[model samples]
Target: MPSHVWNGDDAPPNIHDVYDYIDRELKTLKTKLITKIEKQFFGGIEAIQFLIHIEEIFKSKHRIKRVKSLIPRISGWAELDLFTRTCYEVRRPGGGRDAGFTKDIQTFNAAFQRGIKSLTDLQDELKDLYCVVQTFCRNYQSLEGEFDLKWARETNLELKSAMRGIETLLEEAEEGVNIKLFSSDKFSLEVAETCDTKRYPVLRLFPDLFQKFHFSFHLIGKWRANDQIYLEDIQFKLIKTKRLQRLKHEEYNTLEIEHANLLSIIVEKRVRVKCREIRDRIKNLDQEITKLAGLKRSMMLEKSQTESDIQERKRHLFMNKNVTDIINSKDLDNILGVKKDIEILSKKLKSLNKSLKLNENDLVAKEKEKVALDTDYEDMRKSVSRSNQLAFERTELSKEISIINEKIQELEAIFYRKTDRNKLSQAFEDMKYPAGDDEE
Candidate 1:
């Protein structure tokens, strides 16, 4: 028979071939799914950039509002025309003269609207891809379980069949030897004739006869050749059994290595996905921190202006009249309200400063978390052996993120409280002292 022929009676069926085929299919599917996940993961960058661009647009709009507040309203057509032309020159800077603030604002609003729509669409797509990947992971887990169970069942059956074959061979050898030595009359007569000259009985010669027949048939002159051949076959089978077991062990090791490789691929992809999510969150935190810093600067500026205004009012009162005359009911109430406004602004500034510090601290913590996540991601990506360790690290990072979110919520609450207090203090100040013509 040809060496490649696998259907021979003496040859055990190569059951591992079936497992190899299944494993190949699984590997192909895993590769395709991993590729899809990577593509989607990288594709999310465009969406992230869109969101960042939207934030930039909002920032630009805020700057425009500040500039508009600084520019007093122009009356009459000539003044308005001059202001419009100046705005166009400053904003366009060597571009068209027709470009003006209104046009610029419209353009920015249109871009913002487009960006919002694109971001919405991309977010939806990303969510769908995320769902698909989750489903794939669940299915892969089920497939892994099936593969393990199938492999175990096949290996167990193979081992049991091999043991049964060895037992049958041993039983056959024992039965053949016992019948030839104890139940054959012809063999007994031959043994008696051979031992007659030595005056040895059959029972006395039995040990020597059995040993002679078992080891070397030449001592008995080739008598009962079939029994000698059977004994030699049993010895050959026993000697070859160890070689078969070694081959089985090597095949099992190969299978285990392949399974480990597949599992590592799954784990590495999961880590990369999680790392990307953390990175995006860190970016959002950075943006929020920048926004909070701007708010803090604005609040400080407002507080300084309020303090200066209070000092100016006190100086005016002392310079324009006697201290006793300035202490009338209306003047006293105005002074007290100015002091109250100063006090309220001071408290708000303090609260805002505290909130800003907390945000900075949170930002630092999140940055550190990002670095740790990056390190863990790299380690898991590069080393297959460490994939099992990622789960614990992932859990710890999740907890840290939750804590940071709580801190952010508290900061926001403080900010809102400060805003409400500022509004109440402004109301009291307005009621106690109405705006003068020059201040208006």
Candidate 2:
């Protein structure tokens, strides 16, 4: 007989067989998932490891009695006797040949079919998610310490697209499972009447974690390799324990009820046989909680240290505001003004230098001319002495000419002064003599 297609056969598998088959299938499926996850670790393990962490979350959510009772039946992974009894009751009303009962069985079969189909689809989705993750991990590894702009952009796009694909696949897988659950009419009404199904917190928050990883991808170009790794690891664990406080809250309630229940049972029945088991389980839970708390504290400390290191790096690499402002000055007008002043000063300096060069040339030429004239004067005196014996007299006459020129300048000065004095005396005599003497 086919595993999924169960026509109203004379030999339908009993509930035990059905559950056993499902359990085996579930184990196989888990093995496949683990194998796929392990292959994903070829490039890196952070993202895939997150998926494993999600398994822990699933286990925790389903650990509750009510949730545990609902999940298996609803998902068609296991069936409760109540569900089987309800199916039989519907059939018995028509003496096992009711057309409506057959229809109901068909519907039930279809729901299981859908569940099986969803499982297959979920596997495919997981495969695809791992492929993207593998590609993303490879890119991350190859692009480590890569600061090339073009490469970074392309790699970021690829990584981002891969992240989105992973997220989409995860959502589809979740929806597929949920749809499978809702398809079963026997369990649907029952599930709805009971406590609301609590979704896996990590599943809901996974994309956010994916986002955190992607965000770290952006920092690869700017942050040190070690820093990026630390950031991702720290943030990954942080997100893992993000719902811990709430879990602790739930744990408190669960423990109280469980404690009371255990006490009542032990007091009423005097059952010591199961007491050790219960104590061991409680001890294990306490140990788990303690480990989680310790992990959280360590992660927090690492985060703080990382932050401080990053700050120190920034402080060392980046200039202070004042210095940075001066180097990258945005004050256009001030810059322009300074430039203009420098240009004007440069022009003035060039002009002054040119003038000084010209003056130096003129002085050099005049000095050469003076030397030439001195040589000519000496030659002329020598020629004069050679041609005539009166060279000495000529010299004496030249001296007399210089003396006479001086005397001429002095005599002219004396004559001008005497003439002014004579005019004044004459004026005085004319004033004394009057107009009558002038007429006579």
Best by TM-score: 1
**What does the lDDT come to for candidate 2?**
0.40
* C-alpha RMSD of each candidate structure in angstroms: 56.8, 60.9
TM-score, candidate number 2? 0.19
Give per-residue CA lDDT, model 1, range 91-138, as digits (tens).
523434234344643443343334334333433433333222121111
Candidates' TM-scores? 0.24, 0.19
Off by over 4 Å in 1: 1-266, 303-322, 325-330, 380-440
Q: Give the range of the ten consecutive residues with the poorest summed lDDT in model 2.
A: 134-143
Count: clashes, candidate 2: 0
